[model samples]
Target: MSSIDFSEALDCLKKAQSVLISCHVRPDGDSLGSAAGMAQMLGSQGISAEIILPSELPDRYAFLFEQARPRVVTDDWRRAQLRGFDTVVIVDTSVRAQLEPQYDFLKSCNLPVLVIDHHLESENIGTVELLDPSASAVGLMVAELGEVWPAELSAGGAKALFTAIASDTGWFRFPNADSRTYCQAWRLLQAGVRPTEVYRSLYMRDSVGKIRLLGRALGSLELFCEGRLACMSLLKEDFRQSRAAQTETEGLINESLRIGSVIAAVMLTEDENDSIRVNFRSKRQINVARIAERFGGGGHELAAGAQLAGSIEQAKEKIVSAIREEFSRSGEPGGE
Candidate 1:
């Protein structure tokens, strides 16, 4: 709510001789970019910065790293790294719980735990918390910290931050995107990051397997709420049949919204263990987070998601039923 106190974030950065930045487990562009942007920005101040990613670098975002990759960590390494850093900054994630294994390490950090995130569900785990769900990500919040940023950050830092903002805000298509997102994006552009290149790298760079997986995902789609809702699922087998990784299905939930009469769209992916991961997207007048939260998940109103302990088909049915109930309240077919 208050202007993200870069003065506050800077104080922590300045105190640490060495800094470590971390993001959520399944690192999206915003999480990875926020981590890299912080590293580049702090490098300008002569501070050594590192990124600790929970998983391997996803394929599409590998290009963003030219010199270094996120230091992949085991659970033990994660704790040790969190302990050794002069300061640890958690980005893109609101609560430690969302980060699985690092949840406890972040809490026990001796120096300071600083949280710069945009998720509304944050658990406020840092000594210094600068979280605004209204903003697109911690990268956008970190971009505001350029006042204290070192000279080295002006270019690479901008690209990382811009990519984070662009991805999390659905390329600035979501309603949550505001003047702050666009203004910061324009600022990053001025810093010499090519918008077209970033776009090609982020969205346009999918593999052929990914394209086939998307088609299969769409083929499984069904409509509900008298066509106001659309939902689908892609199992692990679907990815194999399409010769795509699970990541290939990344944008399938978004495509569902393009249909006429669609008020809400959901895509459930069956992970290796058969537990379902849900992705939700919607137009106005529906709050996906409300539905996600009811099922022990969290995110924003317009776009939110959750992980469920059920079959993909069961998850899809539950989510679709939730959507039906949501629209019914509006005097629609399911209710109104």
Candidate 2:
């Protein structure tokens, strides 16, 4: 729970004529949904709001904003537009490094930054931050803000927010999903969001290339710590062979944790820069966020990620060793 008052954020929003909404790099459903929903909410109040993503929007979520797609800032000219806003709203992430393309521009801009997020660890980047680690997702927090502000959500906004909440909470299966989460879902449904339609669009629309990529990822699975830890790798060649983009790897890590014997799962993917992107997921008590922070990344407790500056083999060795040490210190069954 952040000590910052939500009223202060509302006051800032009330005075602003224009707003720029952004999220972390490699934006996920929650990030995109929150941004799009927030933009619509602000627009309903006659405020000009635009979203700037650090990278291209993944194909799956592009439907959330059919007519008003967010601008993906790639070069300096597009990035420079961030300075034109009266207020900036950072959603789903507060980590500075996560805002790569706009980081320098945002730092130089003499504007108020309002952060709305649900992560446990956050950098102090916003003048007014509404952060609740207990919330299932940032969309939940945004919904609560809508109630506080008495903002009327359009049908599209409701659908986008539902996508945000559903994606981040694993469709209400994650531990963070609570009574309030369901209540908000109900509210969004009342506002004309069709859950089945959203679910079909999100889960049932995978392509053949994504399935091939999943096969390659599963083929690379390896077990350690006597089956308590499962690790998988997706090489740069995997993408080429499968004709799959990196975004297709989104849910692969969780698949490794499905085995009955595995307590923790790690997905190591070779990035274009030759670095390894590490994604972590745990079933029970492991705090993967702490593990990610040790490697200069941060996320939630059960689900987290980090980028390692090394070969995939080196990253695997280091991360496996760290997981082993964690198990030993915690007196878990896998400790040797």
Candidate 3:
């Protein structure tokens, strides 16, 4: 990654009258909230800002959009606003590979571009990349970047910041989260964010499809290397029968670790087009993100993902082997 001083990047930001914000493909809460929160902060400072979601916003976040109502840049054809923006900010994505088709065009823009992320693998996705993998959420960091100071978060801004931190940490339950995360969440709450409201925004409903998806996921699960490793795969037909959206496959990999002794587990799912996506989760003894990063993806040490070609069965085998190797290298799967 190239050198970037946020204090120096601050100059480009404060001077720009028009700013456009974006996040990586298949954006999660931290990216979405950071992009929108940055826009809101800029607007508060009397700067004209636009926020765009490169992919369709995930359904779980619909409540946040309804509540904040930030303008999404995708629909507005205003050429001047589009062309006039002097700064472009991308958040949560650490590398170009995560941004997909949008990264090249955005990177080509002659204007100032900044990236704020908390992923360890960022090899510089922008002219200025402010990365703090230790951070709980990009939204928490963006508040600092915006000079909002946790002490000054508005109700809307507080909600955004809180949601970003809470959702990404899996409600303070993720292994990546530490005392700093709770402290930050407390700070956000003091700024007027409601914990219950934000929690509801994250996980309010359970559709019949999601239940079916869960059943299908549990039914297809298999163990390997004794109980040290496990794997599961969801096919297009399984999703269709379950009435589940492809997105519903979230958290399937964690089922492996639920057994309390398994070091790692992987869930492979084939989307409608036959493309396979894999989610990997590891507990106390393994590093799943290390494995995921090898396959061109990254997340927390205990959790990560990768995409593969051909079939879910192929993806399952590959992931299962990776986990088995990770465990075996640790001196023979120590227990049952």
Candidate 4:
């Protein structure tokens, strides 16, 4: 993939008087943090910036957006506001399908579209793109951009950016976290971001319902591919019984990977439209992103996800089979 120069992206942002920043559906910490931090950074430069998300902001991330929470664009009135902006910055994700609700509206807009992301595979959906898979998170790329640009980041922006990087890198435990990631983290700390505060806000503050949901998810865990792969499914009933929102399923897939023998983990949840949302995580060596791409989804090597057009059972069978085949080809044997 061709990489867009950071300077070019900075120039594009400087030219725009107002920019609308957005991210994929079921917004994650990386997306939310990057969008919020970008908005804050742009605002500091005297540019009118706003963050519009396709889904509700998760409760855990509400603090990062307390100064100015992102607006959810689910209706025409909200969609109409897009016309007022001269630039649209799509952060964290570059997939059109992931944008949801806002995908069609963004396509209809005549303004310049700028994509800032760190995904492995990206759709050619933006007029100006800045994609670097080497970066730990889109927030780190944004932090780098800020360093090169004239605008100064506020304390809130630093915290938001820190959350983006920390969450995406699994708090520096993931393989994606390199020296540059640590350097960016140090830079953010210097910019007035409190590591302890951000860490507690993102991870330590779990709700009772969320804990119940996790219990349900863990109870459903099953092993496949000679214990190399761990799989779990959470049905609609799980959400209702646990009184937990779908967003609470955020970190459940990783829990499966904690098993020492499990090189890969998959979580399938029943979503709206009778489809299944699948999240894939790998401990090492496996390229889950390729599997996700084959299923029309995309992400990093160890972490990726896809939304399949089937029920939870069908999704589990198909995905498990795929993973088994992949493991077999890689010299591992056995499946269940």
Candidate 5:
């Protein structure tokens, strides 16, 4: 976590005339919500801020961009346009690898970077950082930053921040949603964010293809480590037959955790490039982030992801071996 004062980061932003904001590749709700919320907050101060995404925005999250539209980079030329901004604010991730192709551009731009994130094992790539791995979500931190500005959050900003905190903590159902998380959420509610409206927008609008894809994923569920570990895989063929977009795979891994005996879960997805995208989730006994780090990825203790080059079967073998080692090292049930 960064020791930089929250006020100091806000002061840096207060000095900027125009700012460019971004988040990690394959951004989830926390990343996108943080970016959107931050952009709205900066706009309230009369600072020009635009969001640039490394990948295409998922269809489900398109609502967030209506008020705070982002420019999704499609090529080298588009990426270059991110330069020349007065300041850069990176939210939800600080790792160079997570920043991808943007990291190269940022190196040459020589702009002062401010990182606001809540994740373990982050890299030092910020001029000022307000990181709190203990915090439930970066959106929470961003909301608190608004409090320091002593500005009442606009309805749009409040909704975006609400999405950030709710999504990261699984709509306040996950264990991470403590009193602080609820308090921040209540404040957003007071700011005119209707919980039912937001929930319908985020969860009740799944496509038919996504439902079929979920079925196939569950059909592939396999138990290992004496049923304490559950793993599922989805091949390109599965996506083809189901006609599901890749983004629909989000949250599918957590389905296995519903089983009483399962303490850990892994979801292996074959991307278009034939490389495997692995997502890990744990109920508490396992530190899935350490497992992801072994494969050159990092995230929270309970949830993490890694990309592996190889056929899905090959990726499965390597991941299973790693999970076995982690379970053994942790000396948990099914370790032997």
Candidate 6:
């Protein structure tokens, strides 16, 4: 939770000759956008920077990189690539668990690490950490960095940054979208970012399989804690039946929050490896991130996620029990 100033982060980058950028696994718009934006910012400054992902880039975000190809690391030996860079910049997350495939390299590499994240929890994963819990998105932090670094945002960079801030704020519909978020959005718009195109690329281009996946996830919805909580799951069979890619599960959990009476929602998906991916979202005072942390996960107060090794049913039971316990501790009735 200790955040460093932008000047400090800029100073670290100022010393780097080459940079390797990265974000959390299962890259979302926020993480992808921030990483892309950071790469562009560094590139404009004449620093050779490239993005290295722990996983494949989601198809929905492929438009952001029409001009560049980010390296997707698939093996342990790829860790040697870390030695080639003077610095590593990890956007959107500071948790070691989220770093995944690169976690070992990051832990062992002597190269300076700069973490730009807004999550409430972090491991001592960075040599210079720019952790800001107040910023709505790490992209917002990057936008602010552009101003301080005095770097110009290319048309692509503006679009990438806009996607970062907008996605993390639920397109400004979430409670986290404060005035700062809107102001940054305005700045990107002034920089010639076309929101309509970005919106269409992100939302309107869903594959049919994604629609089927959404339907299946919604079909599994169950009410809990007297209708105050909603839980949903998508099994391995669900994915096979829907023919949906894992990335399509991105926003499924948020749909349950649309329920008029539900204050919190959970989405549990069975990964191919049989691990359960749990995503938590809330619309009120409950800190779902705290609940996630109990199970070795962390995120913002209202939104968070974790992965558990168990059957989907077992994962659901543990998650539901934890949410109910959190509700009880928060002094809300009907937690039983």
C-alpha root-mean-square deviation, each candidate = 2.1, 1.8, 3.5, 2.2, 2.0, 2.1
Q: In order, how many clashes per candidate? A: 3, 0, 0, 0, 0, 0
lDDT pick, better of 2 and 5:
2
- Choose 1 or 5, whichever is better by lDDT: 5
- Overall lDDT per candidate, in order of appearance: 0.80, 0.89, 0.72, 0.88, 0.88, 0.88
Model number with the top TM-score: 2
Candidate 2 at residue 116, lDDT? 93
- The per-residue C-alpha lDDT of model 5 at residue 109 equals 83
TM-scores, one per candidate: 0.93, 0.96, 0.89, 0.95, 0.95, 0.95
Model 5 regions lying over 4 Å from their true place = 1-4, 78-84
**Which stretch of 10 consecutive residues in model 3 shows the poorest summed lDDT?**
69-78
Best by lDDT: 2
Q: Model 3, residue 323: what's the lDDT?
A: 67
Q: Model 6: how far is 273 from its true place, Å?
A: 1.3
Query: Model 6 TM-score?
Result: 0.95
**Candidate 6 stretches greater than 4 Å from native:** 1-4, 76-84
Error of 1 at 164 (Å): 0.6
Off by over 4 Å in 4: 1-4, 78-80, 332-336
lDDT of 2 by residue, 207-300 (tens): 8999999999999999999999999999999999999988899887888888999999999999988989999998877888889989988889
lDDT by residue (1-336, candidate 3, tens digit) is: 112246755766778798988887777778877776677677777777777666677787766665444444354334454577789888887677776656666666677888888877777767777888777788767766654321334677667777787767777877767776676677667778888878776776757898788898889877788766777778888888988888776655665667865677788888767788878777666877888977767777777788788876767767677666777766656432
Q: Note the residue pairs that clash in candidate 3.
A: none
- Model 2 lDDT-worst window of ten: 75-84
The superposed Cα distance between candidate 3 and the true structure at residue 164, in angstroms, equals: 1.2
